[model samples]
Each structure stands twice: as C-alpha cells, then as structure tokens.
Target: MGIGDAQVSAEDLETVTQQLGRTPRGTRAIASRCPSGHPNVVQTDPRLPDGTPFPTLYYLTCPKLNSLVSTLESGGLMKEQTERLATDEELAAAYLRAHESYLAERDAIESLGTQVTAGGMPGRVKCLHVHVAHALAKGPGVNPMGDEALALLKAQELWPAGDCAETAAG
Candidate 1:
C-alpha cells in the first residue's frame, strides 16, 4: 500500500487487474494513485515471471486515464511530439535523461540486457500512456515530454481542467 514497497495489497492488485481487463504481470509497487486512492500508476519488474522482458517500469493502470491517453494518441499527439523532438534540443535532452532514468530504474530491478527504454523515449513520443505514467510516478520536472503531455491533458486534481483526473479520481 505504499510507493516503492515490495508488498502490493491484494485490493490494489485486483483493482489493477480489473482496470487492465487482464491479470497483471511483473507488478512491483504502486507508483502513483488517483485522488480517490485508486492505483493509477504501477511500478513493475523488469521481467515477468515467464521470463519475458518487460521494459515498462511504470505502468498506467487506470482505465479512465488509459482511455483519455488513448484519445490523445489518436489525436496525433505522438507525431507532433516526435516532430518537436527534432527541433527542440532542450526537450530532446530532457527526454534522453528520462530514458536514461527509466533504464537505470529498470536495470536496478533486473537488467533486460537492452537499453531500449519504454515510450520510444530519447528519440520519439511513441506512447503518451508511458510518458504520462512516467510523469505521474516520478513527479514533475523529470520528463519534459511527460510534463507537456500532462499539461495538455490537464490531468491533476489541482488543475482546473482535469477531465482525466476527475474521471480517475471519481
């Protein structure tokens, strides 16, 4: 019932399973939560029990948030973000750091034997879900793209236009 804690409560596990519509694998910790205490982001192991390499260290587990993020992705946000990476040197550098940070975190758990980080990081914005999950898990100022995506979503209980946040929290 805590961030970075090894023990994940059965309730949280069950909630995540319901959110994903499948039994989750490699879940390690509850990375972040909605205002109502629902687990919105989960920290996972580098590899699954079946020996599958799962590079996603932070997994978004809220169905409502997932739907919103999917909406953003469908809106061609990924393409625009990727294009911005080519010109926004500062953003690109920060994204590379985010990628490195993700790799380090995953490596600390178990090396997947590849530097391939999640979310198409350091190069392109392939997945808004991953970036948003990363931002929620690590907090602000860590992932620039994530922060931007979060802003675009206006996803925070403190924000005025928190459609996703309200959906997840409520």
Candidate 2:
C-alpha cells in the first residue's frame, strides 16, 4: 500500500502490515504507539479502498494488545458494560459524548452518512479492541469503556508498556 500522506514511516506500515497479517486499507496515519515506539494503533480512513464505509477510526495493531482484548471480551466484559449502560447514567452520557467526538473526527475527512460508531459506542460495548484502540489513540477520558479496559489490562500486567511490542514484532 502507498504510504501517501498517512504521516507514517514505511517501516511503521511494514510493521503494522506484519502485525495485522495483511495489508491495511486506507490507513491515514499511525494513531498511537507503545512505549517501545511501535505502532500500537492506526488511524484509518472513513472509507476503505473498496469504498466500504469503515467506521473504525482507530484500529489496534499490536498483536499482544489484540489477544489481551480478545480475552477480556470472552470473559463477558461487553455484557457487563452493556448492563452498566442501562444503570449508570453518568457513564452513559460520557460514552455518548465519545461517540459524537469519534463521528466528528471521521466525518471531517469523509462523511459516512450514518451515526454508527465503532465498538458499539453510545449504547453497548461491542468490541474492546476498538475501545482500547480509541482510548490509546485519543488518550484516556475520551472513552470510559476504553479507559476501563486499559486499567484491566494494566492490572493483569499483560499490557505491553515496554519492549514487549518490539519483541512481538520481531
């Protein structure tokens, strides 16, 4: 894939491609990097190369992070989050703001003409991977669910806050 104005180095794209096990489509930039200086997340275009209205703005690229998030999902984290959305008014409001922000950012590039945000934002927690990617890309406080997921990862000490990302890449 052509680097273009993706604002990412060729090496970064190469590493991301390897991590994803396939070429990325419409990658606009390296959205986030780990402490080891590897691309942990990427900012993808609203529309993919095939004209697909891709809503996932922040795509997590780290293999370790992906696996950790997958484990969290299998543990019924989404169910817990969804339940919270029904009872927690403050959290639900914050999540709605996060969804609006995500849509603004993506629509600034190209309008998707739909209100559908990634990771089931503004309602439920569908994918922790997308939440984590969003949190890592936009930083904490942007997505409460994403921040909570990262905290869980940190508690388990499975999050790659060091050379683990580099090691996984190589």
Q: Estimate the TM-score for candidate 2.
A: 0.91
lDDT of 2 by residue, 1-170 (tens): 22133577898889899999999888898888887777888999999999988999999998888988999999999899999999999999999999999999999989999999899988889999999999988888999999999999899888865455555336
Write out the backbone clash pairs for model 2. Answer: none
Model 1, CA-based lDDT: 0.84
The 10-residue segment of model 1 with minimum total lDDT is: 156-165
Segments in model 1 whose C-alpha atoms lie over 4 Å from true places: 155-170
How many clashes does each candidate structure show, in the order listed? 0, 0
TM-score of 1: 0.89
Candidate 2 has an lDDT of 0.87
Local accuracy of candidate 1 as per-residue lDDT tens digits, 1-170: 34666689998899899889999998889998876677889998888999888998989888777877888799898999899899989888989999999999889878989989999988888888999899989999988877887787675433323543455435
